[model samples]
Target: MPVAFRLPLQVFYEREARHPRQPFLVQPIGGGAVQTLTWGDVGHQARCAAHWLRARELPQGSHIALISKNCAHWIIADLAIWMAGHVSVPLYPNLTADSVTHVLQHSEAVLVFIGKLDDWPTMAPGVPAGVPTISLPLCPAGDFDYRWADLQGCSPIQDDPLPPASALATIIYTSGTTGLPKGVMHSFGALGFAATHGTELFGLGEGDRLLSYLPLCHVAERMFVEMASIYTGQTVYFAESLDTFLTDLRRARPTALFGVPRIWTKFQMGVYARIPGKRLDRLLRLPFIGKRVGHKVLAGLGLDALRIALSGAAPVPEALLRWYQRLGLDVLEVYGMTENCGYSHVCRPGQQKIGWIGLPCPGVEVRIDQAGEVQVRSGATMLGYFKDAQRTAEVLTEDGFLRTGDKGEQDADGRLRLTGRLKEIFKTSKGKYVAPAPIENRLAEHARIEQVCVVGDGLTAPMGLCVLSTVGQPEARHALQDSLERWLEQVNAALDKHERLRQLVVVKDTWAVENGFLTPTLKIKRNVIESTYGPQFQVWSERTEVILWQD
Candidate 1:
């Protein structure tokens, strides 16, 4: 059963009472010793920030924007916002100026917290005039109306009461893959139920360590890293940057680790770079040396202590799941989104499976409608999309079930396997329809391909726009073409006639959030890809060679 949270503020206070001196946050300061903040430290600092908010005299229940990457101060600001009776509006650090502006205007943010960003100059123009901006610690760039120290100068509030369970806690904007982002409003109860339940399910405890590297703006990371730490009184570590991610991970030695499929895939690729996959496969065959090799590999990555390994945000290829399982670390694929408070379903530890998003979580109900839309009615479901009644009505049903636009079916055992998105299916010129997800997952196993987008609209057979992995460089594309063709042929044989990929076009540049090809959550923006490459598809598809190189 989930722990009742009348207000989120109570959770922190309770944790502080239990372990005041325990390190709650371990943050990396560049070129120096890491900074570790205790529970008491966080409590005092957060209280000061809360008092600072009170002095601003903004309207009660005002919206406040938090724009930055993950950090210790981000959590402090979130707690402070709620403590002062204002709802938080977190913005993705990777968001463009247009997106940042839209969220600010849509949420009606009265003030913004700025920290740990590189593109503040570009993002500065988006901020409305006269709206106060407070710069926080670890901010490598930008000047603000108020510094982080200004908040700490105020005396801490002693008797700030916890808000009602029904009070709005946050307005999380979705990382849009196709269009402008939509803000999903969640209550204190909704967020609390998921966090406390997750702590219970994962068996997280005080000694457990967690690495908070993913964007906190995303609900998945927010729940597992921030809320789980608070509810369980666990230690949380922050990554310094991409350069020191390994150092940070090793320092944390997290017992309960969570990542998106992309991060898991990157881990696999990193392993392969150090030790060739073919060689590792050969070694694993030897019963004597195999276990030692796998153990060493995991330990080297600082993941040896990980009791729980989870992946979400995108469909993980079963091959990726088995790759880690061979190392004795099974990746449990979870199913949920921002609308569900990231608590709809989770694969149990020992009963993990490929392709299936395991049983529904406790107090969560999931069912498939006649149209194959996965629907859920859970305590964690968001109240609604903030102020977008029409859009909210489109996704929610009369019976209070949230209509997830994903197409999927439940097995006899109630395991859900998502097929694809309803709107993502495209009809070929041959009058055949194809789902890209399964195909994408299957092809994603190719070691040489970084990302593959299967495009077949108005064509007889689908072709792929692939970005080469670091191993499959542009200069080596010709040498690797034969090997790539062999893999492509094998993938094609396993698919239905219409679903088979005809050709593979290697694009030069990698798809990234900064490049507009991916969302902040690392989801491929299909619309953006189509717009950029749709014009060149016909010319590339007509090539006689099995592989086409854009560069």
Candidate 2:
């Protein structure tokens, strides 16, 4: 059967009935207490939760929101909502009350499911009036109301006819780096198709395991972590936290893992932190020492067992991808967005190439528009943005192709190499177009360069604001600056006259979500960086050398 016609909750329940004792999910809550749930338990719990939702006297297809960290119950609530024929909306845990209010008001969600409730007070004001909320780990201390367990005691609902495959199943809000968050509506067919292709493309099966650490709200995690489990009946493990991510990976020994470029980059840094790149490369030049060291580093990262490690959600520096390749992990770069049900293109196992997002996935058609913007027609194209038809028309073409808003080209071998966002291209003072992503990707490819923002708006040539190399020692910082200058010279020589970087600013700190420089998925907010540092670039540009920020 085509996956687009399959209901995931139905299949998951069948797996539970077939193998009640088999582990479906393994999560460590805290203090040596583990939360283990088999498919049977999940099936039973979701049915009861479905029954409770049905009894709520709300209209069918009503919206229910989930706000939480990565946890097992977060997923359970999601499936339960779908079982009840409702739309599930997930919110990032780090969003402020104002932003949360906007989503709640925008979605008109009837109820909320909050997991790992730490700071509920800050989130309380965001809940729209008349909406009831249920907390997963901890119940709301005040009037917010309800606990996850409250619905568990309800009667288990026998399956009624499941919703039609074309019915709206989920509404994922885009992170909105460029504009206000739009509720991206996806049908069961769209999501299921992505899972089907993803499972087959990655060779996922019953034996495979996956660690879920990235925000479940994100389409990448939702597709790779959640839907992969449904398609292949693989065990899905939720990470306790970043500190426990490695331990969880080792414990699960995941065969399939998905991470953003920043995470992969950090893993590369961790490997090199113990063994300097020069010594390691020299050792790798030999036969036995190189093999031994490579195995050790991969094993330490718990990635030695990974068959398919994916990087997506933002452009990854080619250097990081190649570094992992040297260590024997075939890290494939994927290009996708929430609108496409989290998949559009992927690099197959043996066909990886750095600096390219790779070939289109099975069942997806990709073509470059005359303006160089990539367009896609696929089974997974979103139905439309919720209640925003005009906005939907803006992205979806009249001929059924979805405008990707990304400028890219297909290589001779059909691999899609993304250049930058069509909207993000800036015009320099010399009236030349500057594509920052390609430049940023190249500059960030340097071993000593961590994060970079290519800035040249209204300027003669683009200059870079870079997060300094994390591995540099106090004395090495100065020397690293010299090395970066030389690296830039090489990069500049390869660029067109207008594309060359005029100067570089070495930022002392890493751009992090906590610092408001990067989004939760680790994509740099170009507007924020440009606005924050644009004034300083002129002063620093006068000095031709790398301007190191001391404080």
Best by lDDT: 1
Model 1 gets an lDDT of 0.87
Q: Which parts of model 1 are misplaced by more than 4 Å?
A: 1-7
Error of 1 at 7 (Å): 4.1
On a 0 to 1 TM-score scale, where does candidate 1 land against the true structure? 0.97
Candidate 2 worst ten-residue window by lDDT: 1-10
Q: Rate the local accuracy (lDDT) of all candidates.
A: 0.87, 0.82
Task: Summarize candidate 2's per-residue lDDT along 1-551 as a digit string, tens digits.
Answer: 23344666656766877888888888787765678898878778878898889899789899999998878788788888988889999998888788899998899898998886556788778887778888775333656477767888898898743677788898999987866789999988888778777778876788889998888898889988888897788998877767777788788888888999888888877777888888877776677777777777888988778888888887888767767766767788888889998788999988877777789988888889889999998889999998899999999999888998899998899999988989889998889998888888888888876788888878877888888656753436667767877888888989998899887777766678866788878888887887778777777766656445535
Tell me the lDDT of candidate 2. 0.82
**Model 1, position 432: C-alpha lDDT score:** 94
Question: How many angstroms is residue 85 displaced in model 2 relative to the true structure, after the best TM-score fit?
Answer: 1.4
